[model samples]
Target: MTVQDIRAFNRFYTNVIGALDHRRHLHAPYTLTEARVLYELAHSPRTDAADLRGELSLDSGYLSRILTRFEQDGLVERAPSAQDPRRRRITLTAQGRETAALLAERSDQAVGSLLSAVPAADRARLAEAMRTIREILSAGRPPRGEDIVLREPVAGDLGWIVQRNAALYAAEFGWNTDYEGLVARIVADFAEDHDPHLERVWIAELDGRPVGCVMCVRDEAPATARLRLLLVEPDARGLGAGDRLIGAVVDFARGVGYRDLVLWTNDVLAAARRLYQRHGFVLTAEKPHRSFGKHLTGQDWRLNLTDAQQ
Candidate 1:
């Protein structure tokens, strides 16, 4: 609680930010602060100027100057707010949105690069450390820990599962739509014909938003279950969601007379591999293959439920 400790942490985090932000031309077309404003405007359309100021905690005069610059550049347009004639509304033009999207892509690339240096085993600790900092320092109440719930997939979750898998892989690994096609096929097959007794999906919700999902289904081999498509968003990571989803799958498999649980994952997914290892899964086999535009080693991991019970 001492000021010195907080100042030291601030310096440490500043270095981390510099590493991520100092990548090639992060602030070329826009300053870091201006890029942040563009990001906010991109996500929240028809927003009041004053509200934007409050949301970013920017000085009103400083924000007005930036908006003026953006207007001069034809990046955004301002109008009187419909809710309050006295207030001003801000909207990003098509050009502005394009700029914002470019900035977002650059940001994602920079983050992906920074993360590549961190070993997979250390990523969960890093994510947890960052989440703790954000939770403790943010102005509002931190996201509710008790609000997390796991439920069966509903009408739209299948689509969500496919889309999120595709988007996450694309952003993090530069994977192509071929991966999306594979996930779509798996989901479509599940939808077409899956036994209720031997197949199930769990969607992890935080604050009522789906942030993670996994599916357990009967394997081709008798008395076996396959775990597939497990994913947790960055925000939901380090919050026990992945662990919860996998635990649910294991429990259900063991409950329904399954002798073994098996999963296939690429070696690049080291964090997930670690999680599977912690749950007593053994790496049975691996082989190199070209997949999703990368040369990767595909692995088969298995957990023996009968052994687990003993």
Candidate 2:
């Protein structure tokens, strides 16, 4: 798209979203920037003026004035950080939290009303287009390893896992739909009959979007666990997602008293194999197979948890 196209879209979106309207922000006394600051403080674990300035890209003097106004209005409290008394930490007071919550609810309602105007069939397309725009823009500056979070799967995560794995593998490795079918079956079985005590799935997210996944499941052999469906998106590589997912599985296996953890992967998956080896997994077996419309060597790698515990 041309610069004019982007600028026109931005202008249209700003008007549609009331981005220039300070008075429309929940009919509150605070401005839009103030509401954003309150929201960030409410959601963040650590908050400081420098970090806020960097995040919002605000002029330091302007941000200081806003913070001063917030403090005067009893919407914010600042204190010396316990970890570093030299630095001041900002937090929302009870009144501030209430105000922030109100702003959030109003904002959500406004967006909901806007979206409600669109046909239901087109909402998904709209959302996907927004995601595509974000992904394309963010391709230049990916998140760091520290920003990645590995969490348990929630509703709809299984379907995402299957879709992402299928699309990524097919595009990158020329794998066929059979690979996607395999992922679908594994996910379906896990969702249907997984044992809570011994089986677990982890989804790695960066900036709230899933970029990788892995699962630990009960193996057929006694006291053994199997690692399955370990995958990291191409855009998310080099951020240590694969290593983190493997580590989560290994730690879960050891915590649950499993004797060994095993995983089957193809030799062509060199990056995954490297991560497995670094995590103390030893190659045990390999064989050539024609699957996923390709001739590939399926290999099994095992890690002994008995030694890991010591």
Candidate 3:
């Protein structure tokens, strides 16, 4: 949609639901921008201002002004980062937290009240459509919302990947304890000694949120690499995340002079198989494997890394 079309829709929505007016009144004490800063600080306390600046995509002077006003109003506090003396970490004060909570409650009520008229089934469809629209709009777009970035996994991203993967596998494949243990071991090994030269992890990010990840390990043989632990969040399945992850691993292997790449996966992983095949990997071996709660066939795939891959 064009800008004009979006404006027209906004106008229709505001007039019909009185949303815009209600929001203005409810947030009279603080401008939307200031309130957003408060909300971000409330959720992610002690965030560095530089990080916020990048997340919100605000000019340094403009952000400083907002923060200055907030500080004068006794709504937030700023402290020097212990790790980085130059960075100022911002956090909400008690008053700021309370105000943010009230704002959130009011906002939720406002949205819920507006949506209540829609039937449950229709609401689900609406929600799905909205999610699809958001994904389309946000493709390749940096998240510039509320001075806080929702991010994907990065090279050093920790915590959320482990938790999200465990939950995701449990929901998707009925994968349980064994899968979790395997993931735990991989994470532990990476944490203990991540050799950037020999191996690396790649993550897909949305506004900084870690949504997908893959690890590539160099093999003992002179020009070989092993791909492992590839995963993409269910919410972030589309937008070619899996493809990008595999490409990153392949590119990394090639950069390090690997002449071939290999991976092992279960037969049930149809999407992954397609991605592997798209990247020039061919299934060279298959065998029935009784493990991880199911009797399934495992496929070992290998790619001849041509000059481009090398």
Using TM-score as the measure, the top candidate is: 2
- Report the Cα lDDT for residue 32, model 1: 83
The stretch of ten residues in a row with the least summed lDDT in candidate 3 is 145-154
- lDDT digits (tens) for residues 1-310 of candidate 2: 7999999999999888775244355636777788788866654433778777877889989999999998998888787765577767777666775677678677767777787889999988888898688768878576787667666666689999999999988988899999999999999999999886578788888866899999999999999999999999887899888887887787667655799999999999999999999888999999999999999999999999988232
Candidate 1 global lDDT: 0.82
lDDT of 3 by residue, 238-292 (tens): 6677876786677556545678899999999999999999888999999998876
Per-residue lDDT of 41-120 in model 1, one digit per residue for the tens? 75433257987787688999999999999999988888786568798877776677678767877877787788899999
Q: What is the lDDT of residue 309 in candidate 3?
A: 24
The better candidate by TM-score, 1 or 2, is: 2
Question: What is the TM-score of each predicted model, taking all chains together?
Answer: 0.55, 0.57, 0.51
Model 1: weakest 10-residue lDDT segment is: 139-148
lDDT, candidates in the order shown: 0.82, 0.82, 0.71
